[model samples]
Target: MSKQQPVLFSIGWNACINCGACVAICPQEAGFVSPFDTIAVDRPCDIACLLCESICPVDTITHVPVEQPAVSVVTVDR
Candidate 1:
């Protein structure tokens, strides 16, 4: 069976620096830098694919497992 895609959310989104790293690293072409210079994701993406999540330098974006309720799982670099 196909794995479910993850839903991405920006936590404390005001902290985003509008760096295009998310867009640049997204192999699924799911994320983009908005005209207002903010990070945005419009397309669906696979949860198993961590390309964007791992590449985000600021750790502003997060994803919830498809099986779980949509919640913000904050990713931080320790």
Candidate 2:
């Protein structure tokens, strides 16, 4: 069986309202404030937790569902 990759933390910068909710709620301390951008993920989320996704009131943060590859089998006809 093909394995489906787990979803990870993500954010939509365009939709971000500059709210500090994400920065305040993340336990991993992955989020931070930026001078140019309102907030940024300073580093990759090593734990891959969904805390950032749930805390965003504006729904700017989200997770991308992994796409599973198709399986094929070969058959011989006699």
Clashing pairs in 1: none
Clashing pairs in 2: none
TM-scores for candidates 1 onward, in order: 0.52, 0.50
* lDDT string, candidate 1, 1-72, tens digits: 124555554534676776767667655433344554444444334444666567777777766554432335
Model 1 RMSD to the real structure? 9.2
The TM-score between candidate 2 and the true structure equals 0.50
Q: State the lDDT of candidate 2 residue by residue for 1-78, as single tens digits.
A: 113343444567788887777767655433344553434444334334566677788888776553321224323337
Each model's C-alpha lDDT?
Answer: 0.53, 0.54
